[model samples]
Target: MSDSAVSTSRALFERASVVTPGGVNSPVRAFNAVGGTPRFIRSAQGAWLTDADGHDYVDLICSWGPMLLGHAHPEVTAAVQAAVGRGTSYGTPTEPEVLLAEEIVGRTPVEQVRFVSSGTEATMSAIRLARGFTGRDVVVKFAGCYHGHVDSLLASAGSGLATFAVPGTPGVPASSTALTLVLPYNDRAAVEQVFAEHGDRIACLITEAAAGNMGVVPPDPGFNGFLAETCRTHGALFVTDEVMTGFRASSRGYWGIDGAQEGWVPDLMTFGKVMGGGFPAAAFGGRAEVMGHLSPQGPVYQAGTLSGNPIATTAGLTTLRLATDEVYDHIGGVAETLKTAAAEALTRAGVPHVVQSAGTMFSVFFTDPAHGPVRNFEDASRTDSTAYAAYFHAMLDAGVYLPPSAYEAWFVSAAHDDRAVQTVLDALPAASQAAAAAQGGAR
Candidate 1:
């Protein structure tokens, strides 16, 4: 199939629109923010995606963060296959889950973990545990720091919802979101003020250890430390939602990077994405006492029939084992290469831009120093998104796939090597030109 042969995807999408909401299982897949038909992906390997139209593009979105080792890695595929032969869903305890949990704890050394089905489930359960342990009702989150679509956490979501400009999903009751206190990212004083007012009623203050949902916004110096101390002083649990940054950010993830340096650790941390190796597995863990508040051990209740599904566990274990020190170094190198290339391209085009990054995750914002640095969601909202959309389509047309929205981070996997880097670089000139042309259209 070629892009011209629209029979398969177009026909499928047309039929799907009537049955599924917006013709996509996920809203971002509709490409509404990017203003074009989405290339339906059929298969992926290494750093490339083959679309249903038979077009091949070097993938930078990396399946929204899980493909840190790239799609269909041999070791992961083999492990999943072996587990499948044993059985898909045991609905019982499995050794792989234990091994995966051991690997996570061994790496982070912060707490005991419980595996769940998705990042949403992990955050949902973690919030419930925090509430149960603290005997409180309020949860604090930052604007533009998405922790998945759990009803309470979507007050100021950043990813797909931000991309599409959907105010809030229609189904969630307004009262359900009333308890969520949304604040600006990287504002310590604001956080302190909120804690001063509502700390007693607040069960937890959750944030992306590094905010990837809003284009790789790293913590300001001493920011994570302030959060840790504030939470402790106020008797609120500090929960780091590392679903996108978990293993992909570093061997131990963003918390290990910032928390260790600051001599602080969150009371609870959630993990997903790269840890699952593209499978639907996630976990939340922290101090044993805090985690103990969850289920059979305490009053908070969370259970899933597929909580530790064998196949997902096997995939997770294989990916975690493969992400050795060398793998991290390789991913870091690739990220640097991409960042340098993008910066050079933007500079040469005389485009005012800011490249925000952490480990292998990065995003390019079409704004200058006059914006006073994108410290929070309000600053991030000032980016030239229409320019980004044009750049995205140009890159896609030139055989490189970036995240469709300006708000989302572009991920670099260990599998993206010299060839992938060169491919993106080759596409940059045209993408830059397109971005410059579209700059005035940004709102």
Candidate 2:
């Protein structure tokens, strides 16, 4: 809790910078947004993380949404341990790969699936498949919806969106992103206008299904329906990038919640995060006609030595199998409790905030009470992020860990029970007070 104690993490960060970019493998982990030394996690179990100094905190970031069953869960650990005994990587097909693929196809009712190493790989391959299948170059993506760091997909995206501060990353050529049209999230008319102009040349229109990157902004009512219908009418493929929302949002991911409820299906869906149970596993799949274009079947080629690594598949399979109806219900209940507690505290503190959610994923946005609603990136950007940074540090000091940036969503896992929820609730008043103080009582 003191500066001297926290300095150990600073020391590690200084050491890390000698070899790694920005002293961290991931930019956000550097704690640039919150303006503090990043805690070096020694280990995690259930819903708590033990820092280098042995300080424990309730983890709401959940490793950026992969530890849905919680870090080092027994069943998942057992599965991974059992897998390690056999081998780590086979480079050849294994039973777990088939089983995992079957499990995914069974849950989502999509056609065949292709396993990949990361969410970025999944989205990248999905885009290639879309272009190959449609013979078009343009891909439409929503502003503030991150589809991984794949060059074209990174344009004007969120999550690491504002952090990198480039209109697009430097490595990607201007011409490559020329076909990557970015639109405002939850704005149907904007999407329609873009498609109206370039629909014929657009291969696909990809989205987050539920916009989680920009602080869990849900699609405006009928927005996704409009996207699906518009894509259909324009002869463009509708691709749902559920890398973060997959499994964690619900058993079948955000598209399941959004699509099943709205009676529409995307041409392709990319999955990762909870599906891999914290391993480097990911997948992309959809209509047979579209997927058939990838390797051994068609001209479009994509392959990875670890594409279907047995260890990752085993962990993923076990995690998915355990995400039963009861688990989902329990997680949902926990989310509700945390949401209510935070909202109640903010309200009582006279702080203006909005808690957006889809299943177990949520984020608290600091805004003027007059803002009322945030349906898109434009609305989400209007939030007082400096106030959020203040609240974030206060929560951290109180042993509640939230994502350092306002753009990232807070995740709840099945392991988060009454105690974890209560910890967050108890910490909220002080955090809200800190936010209000930082904003000069503007709330």
Candidate 3:
């Protein structure tokens, strides 16, 4: 049984805080947004995380959307074991990189792919390549679309709709964001205005294929296609960051559901998460013409020492091969079931909420239905963080772990069998009640 005391977790957190910046490697994991002692997971397997206190909970985060087959998947583990038997990173190109790259090229619109160690590198490299290919200085992005922590991309929307962005964080200098134009997500007019004014200087307009960072605010129907068309019209590259969605949001990522149907292809796409198969592998790729401009072939250069580590690539390859139709079907059904149940629970508890999804990835907003359909960062900001914190703790107490913040996607895996699903479903009523209680007189 799970304990509310969390005494051991508290102690470990205290110890870790002395060494680590915030007692966690990632800011979100610190529970700063949720207001509680974050559970330190000792291990995970088959849709369950065993915390340091030996309490097991249903894992809804799924390592921020990578473990589609679920934690400690047998086949993936076996592949990695075999790979480790050979050796770890060699700093030299290996067979697994070739195989994994081939798999990526087959699955997406990317014509040629270059491996990287993380989503950040993939985005940073893609942007550089875009600038190089266009010989332009400006880059456009949308609010709520997180494309990793690249210096230029770490920017907030400026004072006006068509203005250049200001630094969103303290460390980012104004000069870093000087050339970035940040606009609202789903606002086509804003996009058109920015391009109309700065199209010649704009190298690329990058956005998440679906905005999962702001709790899965999916691109409006025909939205991504619109971006592609606009960029094409201006000779600017259209770059879609699929770091959170690739493979997790359908076999080929969110692009599979949207771009494939719309018949538009991005000039560049950055991928991570599911492609890494829970490892640190990531990549960026695009049409042959654009990709040819990257390193050895042309001028834009990007390299990583552990870009395609054999163990990581082997694990990613195995996971991708195993991510079949059945895997997606299972995850989608589970997501639908859970989202429906949570809606019902929230309704019963008198807590107005809206649930949004991007393929299999989804998030429940602690906002009213009337003000919903969160189309941009401002709309996403209306999500009641205080209510979410209460709900998060309530769910944690009930043995279903959600994302530490409201502004994040919930993931499910083929391994989320009946037992794990039941645990979450069982927890929803109480969680909704907590949210309702916390949101008193506000909604």
Please report the candidate that would top TM-score against the real structure.
3
Q: Give the candidate order by descending TM-score.
A: 3, 2, 1
True-structure RMSD for candidate 1: 3.5
Candidate 3 residue spans exceeding 4 A from truth: 1-4, 440-443
lDDT of 2 at 19: 89
How accurate locally is residue 5 in candidate 3, as Cα lDDT from 0 to 100?
63
User: Candidate 1 residues 262-378, lDDT tens each?
Assistant: 789889999998878898999999999988887788878899999989988889899999998998899888888888889899888877788988767888888875776678877
Indicate whether candidate 1 or candidate 3 has the larger TM-score: 3
Better of 1 and 2 by lDDT: 2
Per-residue lDDT tens digits for candidate 3, residues 287-371, read: 9999999888899888888888898899899999999999999999999999999999999999978998889989999888897
Q: Residue 40 lDDT in model 2?
A: 92
- Model 1, residue 74: displacement in angstroms? 1.1
Task: Report every candidate's CA lDDT.
Answer: 0.85, 0.86, 0.92
lDDT of 2 by residue, 246-330 (tens): 8888898887788888899889999998888899999999988888888999999999999989999999999999999999898
Displacement of residue 310 (Cα, Å) in model 3 is 0.6
Model 1 spans with C-alpha error above 4 angstroms: 1-7, 156-167
Position 264, candidate 2: lDDT: 90
State the lDDT at 5 in candidate 2: 72
Q: Is candidate 1 or candidate 3 better by lDDT?
A: 3
